[model samples]
Target: MKLINKKNKKYIQVFQLFTEEEWTKSAKNYNKNISSFFSGKKYEIFIHTNEETVTYLIGLGKSTMQNFEIQQVAVKFSQIQKEKIQAVPTLVLADFLKEKQFEEFVKGLLLGTYSYPFDKKHSIWNPKFEIHFENLSQKKLDAIGTKSEALVNGQTACQEWLNKPANLKKPDILSSYLKNLAKKYDLKYTVFNRKKCEELGLGAYLSVNQGSAYDAAFTIIEYKTTVKNAKTFGLVGKCVLFDTGGISLKDHNNMHYMKSDMGGATAVIGTLIYAAEMQIPVNIIAILPITDNAISERAFLPSDVITAYNGKTIEVLNTDAEAG
Candidate 1:
């Protein structure tokens, strides 16, 4: 993805408007009528072509802007234009929008164009478009660029991990990946293997691991800052790499997507990466309980009573309720 300044005026001009009046004024240069061409609805795109240049006008619906609205608009634009849009210069008409809004706009564009072609030979739409922002200071532009890149990179990593096949993304593999990430980011990490889990009396976590051939891994990621008496945040993620419903098996239909049962873990990892990259001044502790629920002779059976790590015995009503 190329990010160029507004010096290159030859690219396609993209404008965002809040109201019909704003849309009319913005489209005046293109010699087009707003109402005749397209409805001034939120996220509605009106493409105009002339012998000289091509321009796109998008409506923001109301006067106030929201983060998700920006993302939705960008996503719609990306879908319609696809890879054909090589260069786009965004013209922000709403003066109320600040650096954060610009950052969100850039983030929306990056995320909207993102596609995952897992295990495929080639991607269908790999957009390599250049984004240019107009009427922004150098400092704001730099900040936007940095923020957008970090957000996109973090989201992309999470998406890839979630999309990976269950066979390739078992408990051990995810633990190794987190270890490598912690090392790369200079974060403190601890991995508890099956033996360590048993020693530490993590019976609740180990109970879910009993049926799988792969060993369970409990991982802890710590990010510390230099601020004095900083607030500490604890995040717990359910790292069920693949849930097969255990003894109470699910239907084979669409069960392949069960690999994404570990989405909570992926989100935590992504948040940690983004925070580390941006050097956020806060202490964070992330706990990932990684395992898979499979059917085996050793699997926990319904109506069986088991003691958890807290020394509390509970009756299992259903093996598929492992997440509880």
Candidate 2:
């Protein structure tokens, strides 16, 4: 297995020759053929047999691929590793014509690989997998390899940060991690304490965080530029790191996915880290508001209008959508 790069542009050129109908028909046929291969369930498992490993087709979703969902999938699959399922193969279905789909497919594949068990009862289950993509040209695969390497690193970092249960990764621990990362990257960071939040008129944000036993924080990270007064792109992410929906509360079923509500913030941080690492010549301001929206007497309720940093008032139409 060789890693292809842009040098194999010919494969991409061939993919471009097909019409939409041709591509879809080909994709369907490929799927059918693969499904048939696994039809008899003939693949068997032994103590050591790579041949026993079978191909599983995972859809990349009709909509855009969500990072957090991908992270969760990785987390789930990692458990299978604990069961001694090594060398699993995956195929991501996508249209080669859509660049975003192709990219997300590769990224998801990498994310899935991140879910390997470090320790098992007797032996650790490290990850080993062969990933195959349908309808992707060698050129596209090369381009994907180049871009995915960086994204995979970022995703891995985010996954590790999130994998720790809430007890181990409370506000203080998260703050410390950010601080160390900031210092290492030579970036400037300002963490807003509860008192600071009150003074800044961040009622909307504070209200959601009131029930958290842990101190909430608004982390403002700044990546500066060599040129003085360089324009900075401000990325404002809603970071209720864990949302239980406060006072209003959420169903147990819904709460399971709330772990990912802070996914947007996680992604913003991931992007900034990559940008700084690459020495991208641009200033960036990352705003992360991390909190938990749990049900409690202190939680904000419906119809409570709160103001944002920009002084925009939001009437709480749905108690669940409230943000500080």
Candidate 3:
């Protein structure tokens, strides 16, 4: 989306937002079909067109919505409108909405417009637009654009990673991806191979990786800011790219969905990316224990005792509960 300073009164599509109370008083001004169809019910949209303009009357239940509520409404509105309202569209924001609300609105639109990039044969249409809002400072506009872009990029990265097939993203493949992400932000990146894990006494993690065809790796990423005395946050994400349940096998019905076992790690990466994009003044130390739980003669058996990275002994009671 492009934001322009040039003001234009003519628009192909216009969004008219109204709360229940406001809609009640203004409903009579429109035709009976539109007024009867639209009573400002939350998430309901009524389209009214004349010889001159096409207007979409959107319903906002009340003025007292929380920030997430406003974002939820915007997301729904974006999906409903989809590619129908992007070119030269005018959004008549309700006066009751603050800058934060507007920011959430943009965020929702970007998120809703996003489609999986890998699938070219079938994809949702994302239309770009030139938009101008009234009474907004340059600083506020910049903030909205920056935050919205960061969030969409971050969230999209996680979704794509988590949705990738296990075959495409084995342990080594996942670490390589993380390394590139770290380098993009100039963050410190380190990966401990299977030998290093054994030396570091990360037995519990290694035990789970012993049966995999690919080697095990532990990835650590650090995001540091230049701010003096900045507080640091530590995050640990389990990156079991695929969980086959090893000896204690998972039910076959939903076993394929195990590709999402790395969701935790992808989520952490997403947060790190978002923070880095926003240039947040803080330090983030993230650790990802990456491997798959596969079945083979080398796999750890039940009741085996293993030493964890912290040097604590872990007695494996249930093999499926390796990372649980």
Candidate 4:
């Protein structure tokens, strides 16, 4: 997990090939033409062996790169070369990229190693790898490394939460998890129980929970930095721990992935965690309305009318749309 910039160090070289012009410059020492092994097709990989070392040439089809695309390309490269790539020091020849591009490249590389195996027993591979950039300044590289680490850590947490099973990730459990996170991170946290939710007139949110055996959790987490005049940001997340289509019911096919219905909640929590971890100079408040949509006699009917927190009356057309 180290990021260093040392030219004399021996490391695997990753060359990003975009155009014939860049390819000619990169392949100069190899005495090869751009057409010899690659045509700059995006995500294309070419391995070149010299007497001393092996080089990996990857294609970037477009001149303009996006963060998500960079992450995908890195994931593909890592998966293909998983056996060959150990936790050794690696160099990315990114002299052509600007600071932002280089930052995203580093982020993509770190995120590419992410995998989810659920509760299944599996062998754990060492995720420790060092990356070295040849052309970027040490200060800039350090900054990029810090930012990338924060982003990846947050994203990893979000993915793990989303991948958890509905049975293990009930609304109360999720609320307690966030409360613990707030305590660990020294953030302000609050959770409203079912009665408190009723007092607050959260009928719309509570209605979605009536059918479930679990009580709904109305949770709020706040992160306030020391920065003066920091802008306050409020984030609201839909925390449907599980969605069973309520009384309407969903098709049995692929209904298991309903565990990910709380993705927005995880995203909000992840963002708050990232901001708190990085000590970002901003005030953030996250509101999560946690519930589960299931089938029962207590469940709201399709023709039922409910009142929302804002005193708006909503006629339930379908309980399947409860998460909406």
lDDT (CA) per prediction: 0.72, 0.58, 0.79, 0.76
lDDT per residue for candidate 2 within 23-74, as digits (tens), equals: 3454454445543332211111112113433323232222343444443433
Model 4 pairs in collision: none
Of candidates 4 and 1, the better by lDDT = 4
lDDT of 3 at 231: 99
lDDT of 3 by residue, 237-264 (tens): 8789999998888999999999998889
Model 1 bad stretches (over 4 Å): 1-21, 25-29, 32-34, 87-97, 118-130, 321-324
Worst 10 residues of 4 by lDDT: 118-127
Give the top-scoring candidate (TM-score): 3
Q: Estimate the TM-score of every prediction.
A: 0.85, 0.58, 0.91, 0.88
Better of 1 and 2 by lDDT: 1
TM-score: the better of candidates 1 and 4: 4
What does candidate 1's lDDT look like per residue over 225-260, in tens digits?
A: 888898899999878898888887877997898999
What's the TM for model 4?
0.88
- Evaluated against the true structure, the overall lDDT of model 4 is 0.76
